[model samples]
Target chain A: MDRKGILLVVSGFSGAGKGTLMKELVSRYDNYALSISATTRSPREGEVDGREYFFRTKEEFEQMIADEALIEHACYVGNYYGTPRAYVEEQLALGRDVILEIEIQGALQIKKRFPDTLLLFVSTPDAETLKNRLIGRGTESLDVVEKRLSRASEEAEGIENYDYFIINDDLDTCVTQVHQIIQGEHSRVSRNLELINTIKKDISKFQKG
Target chain B: MDRKGILLVVSGFSGAGKGTLMKELVSRYDNYALSISATTRSPREGEVDGREYFFRTKEEFEQMIADEALIEHACYVGNYYGTPRAYVEEQLALGRDVILEIEIQGALQIKKRFPDTLLLFVSTPDAETLKNRLIGRGTESLDVVEKRLSRASEEAEGIENYDYFIINDDLDTCVTQVHQIIQGEHSRVSRNLELINTIKKDISKFQKG
Candidate 1:
């Protein structure tokens, strides 16, 4: 059976290794497609349109919003960022599990819009590990690290709303767990109604015979 | 973290290979424990108490029912059969995923009692395959096979209520899929509340510091 793909909305706190986990998963598995966002912000150096982001003008982005062509959209720092509905649909039609890495608000919006969307919140084993990982990056001041932790704490409040809470202590294990979740979701009774109907039809033949 | 095991209720048609699937699952994995049912039926030759079943007299079984010990109980053919609550609880506390293979009615009852129970319904790919398998068994007469098939058709109506619909065309693949479903369920947010709370507490430390 050619099972349809699921929309996987992945949200995580800063320094939770969600980015690394996604990278490894895509590299290891050919069944996943990382969803690219559309933005009004100008592309940075070495960035390509549709590769990094689908760069669009402010007017075009607004048109998309009016047309409802984006699954979820948000304006940040005078630029609009949104997940393109067309690209996601195309990937899904091809049976590739589409991964959308977004914040809690956008994740919740996607879930409300598409109830079947699998919402997963990735986190470290504990707050101490999360704090240390942020500090270990050494790319920011202790003040910045503390601010990230505060933001993470705020995000933690919404983790309960997610379908799954993934502890990313081990990257390999976390990736496998995520893969398994998407795989098992395909077997959901709701998703396999067509298969069930086929079986039901086949069973009726015996009654006639 | 020592995660508490979940209650897995498996139900399927007679020729769906659920028995073979369960046997393979137990042989390949060490984390699962098949729940033993208590029954008042006389033990057949070589049937040892607590091995094949927890043999009990009608009075003893009634006493258990009065004590509110059975998760679910039903009378069939002048005998009482039930899932003992004590053994299931003991296995769960030890972090073992307890497997309960029962009929649709009993499976639904267990789900109603334990809201956290994961219910899975297994089936063949098509009704033709199911019919052929029953005939291939060669143990049952054609009349008995028709009755079993009729029962399966009736049972199919309740499958939509199950969490997953596992197609058991390939025994090995079906076993692996079942294992993955259980493993992925462990990551569900409702099941990991204690871990989430621990993280919340650890996060509070950062705020104080």
Candidate 2:
């Protein structure tokens, strides 16, 4: 059977190495595609449209929402960001597992719409390591870091709702675990009910004959 | 975190290679352990107790059930058969995945009690091959083969309820797919929520400092 692709929703706190893990997953797996989100924010240096984010005008982004073209969208710092349904569907139909690295809110929205979607929440091994990593970044100010930490705690409370969790203690292990989760979900019996029904019919014909 | 092992319920028609797949799984993965079923049926020649089946008397089986020792049990043709709860629990507590090979009815019963258990239904790619294999065995009469085929068809109808459907077209491929399913299920977020919670707390603490 030509099985359809899987929709993977990944959420994690800042400095949890989510980006690194996603890079490793896509690099290692052949049939995985990372979703490109549309955003109203200006692109950073060296970031390409349709690769990093589908840079959109504020009007265009609002229109997308009105048209329901976005699967899940959110407003951040006066800028809109969202996952486009068109690209995700195209990739899924092509049998490529689509990965969506979104926040807990976006993940919840997607899950509500697509209950079958796999939700993975990644985090550090412990609080000490998380604090160390945030400080190590050297980019965020102490105040900003504290705010992020508080937000992270709130996000952590939502972990119970996720389907799987990956510890960012070791990048390789986390990637491996993530890969296994994807593979396992693909084999979930609920997804293959059609094939099973077909086999039953075929077997019945043989029995009668 | 040392997560608990998975409770795997594998069921299929005869000649679907369930036994072979289980053997290969346990041999290849140290984390997996096959649950030895206890049966009141007399052992065949060369069958070893605790390996092939935990041979027990009818009274002994009844006593075990009265004591709530079995995970799942049933009476078949005046013979009692069941899975021992203690052994399965011990192995699972040790973080070893335990697989139980039973019929669809028994599997459903187990699923009712343990909704988290992964149920796998195996079948051949097509009917003709199944027939050929049945006849190839040369141990059963043509009538008996037809009976088995009919029963297999009925069993196949229940495949929809299972968590996975594996086509036993090739031994190696089927075994590998089953292995992948096991690995994937372990990655399920539902099973790792505790670990994720711990990680989230850690990250929050790190970010605060």
lDDT of 2 by residue, A137-200 (tens): 8776788677777788878888888887777888888888888778767777778767777777
Off by over 4 Å in 2: A42-49, A56-60, A66-68, A206-209, B40-48, B55-68, B76-79, B196-209
Predicted chain B of candidate 2, TM-score versus the true chain B: 0.88
Off by over 4 Å in 1: A39-69, A75-80, A140-146, A204-209, B38-69, B75-80, B204-209
Docking class of 2: medium
- Error at A148, model 2, angstroms: 2.3
**What is candidate 1's local distance difference test score?**
0.85
Q: Pick the candidate with the highest DockQ.
A: 2
CA lDDT scores, all candidates in order: 0.85, 0.83
- Against the native complex, each candidate's DockQ, computed on alpha carbons, is 0.52, 0.57
- Per-candidate iRMS values, in order, are 2.1, 2.5
TM-score attained by chain A of model 1: 0.83
Give the TM-score of chain A, superposed on the true chain A, for all candidates in the order listed.
Answer: 0.83, 0.89
Alpha carbon lDDT at A51, candidate 1? 78
Model 2 per-residue lDDT tens digits across residues B1-209: 43688899999887777888899888877888899899998876777998889999988999999999998898654578899998888998888889999887779989999988999988878888888888887766788787778878878878878888888888887777788788777766677766665565565553333
